[model samples]
Target: MEISLEKPIQQEVSVTNTGDLSEIQRVLTELLYVPDDKLKLVVVLELLDYFKEKFSQKDYKINFFYTKQNGNITGFVVSQIDKEYRSYGMKCPTFGWLTSKDFLSCKLLMGECEDFVRKHKFRKIRGPINFPKISGGIGYQTEGFEAPMLNGVAFNEPSSKVLEYLQELGYKKDAKYSCVEVVESNWNKGNNLDDDIVLKFLHPHEIRELRSQILTLAQNSFYSVLADAPGGQSRFEEMMDSYDLVFGNRFVIKDNFDPRSISSIPEFIEAWESCDLNKIVPCCPLAYDRTNGELVGIIMALPNLFQLWSKEPLTHLNVDTVIINKEYAGRGIFSSLQNVGQITSRLHGFEYVEGTTIYANNDRAISTIFPHSTPLRTHYVVQKRILRK
Candidate 1:
């Protein structure tokens, strides 16, 4: 008599581990049904190479999980005990997987993950997450499949089985956040930016020249949010690599109210990274303080190419990271940046703008951010504690 919850079959689900890039890509191809060209396999390979370059010698751990049924592979999950999780003794190696269509396979794979977690002596498994929380939505989608998959979200409602399995296994919501959609016609683009602040859009041709200032502003601008978190330096490194990829496409604001402000075009271009006058502007924006001459805030975004996976192409944008200086918190800088990224996206032919992981207790986002657009779905990153005996 078979005792496993997984259905009785000639071939039982088992675990095999590998860190081979080709195997990983093969698994991804089996999981994500998209054209090879549109999928940009090279970008993913580049990301893997980047991490390999950074942590090849470190005590980084990676384990891949899969379930094969009747001589065919059906489900897969990749588990990594990387620096982000190891930092500060937070043992949260993330799990990235395609939709687990079979409940039994999902259950078995998760059991293996839990066992892997136990073996590592880490309590509290938090995952089924994408790499780098800033660009990724930080959680799986709980609703909103009618809308097409955007570039930055975790899932598009197909992973309901995994969500169910996590819940059944006692994983509770660590937090819930929503992505609010801002329509171009409904936006008040002229209202949010302060009169004292002059916003500039970075142009593509200026990327190589302004690398240093961009790095400086990026480090200072996000200090409040990222300070003291795990693997902070590695995160900065990731940003540096990613910055060059989207170098000219950015939004920057400088305070014109100060007399010392380098408000002129040449100086502005020299002092900052992302403004150009010749063409349609880019979406990511950085906010600067003229009076104090410091990096005050920033709004970051990236284009979603998931539409390429669909039968019909669609346009989408993800407003991934928005940070306001600790001192500038109440001045509407965050919300303004959100709108600026969204409206800029909308104007540039993007049909929708979305972001997520706004804390449930975030009163500002609840009151100010939610009211600005229609809420499409609830987002969550599920977690469970594993205590040492």
Candidate 2:
């Protein structure tokens, strides 16, 4: 029951699929504390379903590493086969790591990780995925902590110790991303878009029908950068559901009309000094290929603040996603989207807008987003032994 790296990892420890839901909820609530009770339940339900699938199949594993004597759960993770491994005809499959909590020993956790890697003879361990790439993607926020709350924007922030452990085990940056912030200003305007591209707002009722269009564009937009990587359609689909649960209108945050609109950072801070975050306003705009009637770009935004009820205030809005088809890149499509987001957010009285996640090594995306916003925080998608020698 008690697993120690100091002991023989094989005999003293074992990885099992009997991860009870109650135990997981305890660990998640204790360590993660995803703020909203409803959201937390949703997350738990999702995790339960995720573990069920992984454990039921012989080809899968939902790893729960614990102390054998007391049956105390100390570490947890999950993984499954990936398309890349199957396509490559490799014996070492790509497994998406699930989660680990508590102040579990770095050596103990890493030993389990290596064990999982070896058992499946996995080519690499792609992780931090909420579950599988088909449902979610990999990520760990590394900055702007202390919100102590979670909503549709960013979920639970993992402990710095997790990153430390991964680094010690020689885990490399499989993907690096940042949540950039853009203060409300006149500079990043919507006029930057190409003349032929027309921006249209998504009707609340249009989500189901438009999901396909958006998905197609999203797939095309992310293919070069994240097609082989995690967090694509699955991530977007999850966000769509979040839009219904967290945001009032099922598409936008409610109307934002605070009389004390912040004009400067100092003003914003002053407003933050005494304010209650009540009003919410979000904008979801899409750019269509005027020539072919095809959807090519999208920009989704929402009113957001860490620690929802804190003095933090809703001065800043979160840009959930910005995707433009690859064939449409470098055409000011993204810039135009940013501009529109800024204008819409500013009009709603938000002093700023931010993106919670965007890959760091994606120079094209970084360059495109840089002109419209400033990087506020960094998050890493840590991975190891994916590509074989």
- Candidate 1 residues lying further than 4 Å off, grouped into runs, are 1-9, 32-58, 85-91, 132-137, 156-159, 184-198, 203-275, 279-281, 307-315, 338-348
* Residue lDDT tens for model 1, 80-161: 6756543223446566543475777877777777777788887767665655433333576777665645554555334357
Candidate 2 TM-score, C-alpha based = 0.68
For model 2, state the Cα shift of residue 139 in Å: 3.0
- Tell how far residue 40 is off in model 1, in angstroms: 9.2
Across residues 1-389, which tens digit of lDDT does each residue of candidate 2 receive? Answer: 97766853443443454467676556554444453544555555666676665567675544654322134444555444533322112333333333444334445655565666677656566555545322233466677564323333334344446666677767776666677666434444344555567765543445546777776676566654451343345555555654554443432323464434533323222322332223222356567787888888877665443323343545555666677788877787776666554655554456756665676667887776676666676656666774332
Model 2 score (lDDT): 0.53
In candidate 1, where is summed lDDT lowest over 10 consecutive residues? 222-231
lDDT of the candidates, in the order given: 0.56, 0.53
Which prediction has the highest TM-score against the true structure?
A: 1
lDDT score at residue 261, model 2, on the 0-100 scale: 57
lDDT, residue 252, candidate 1: 33
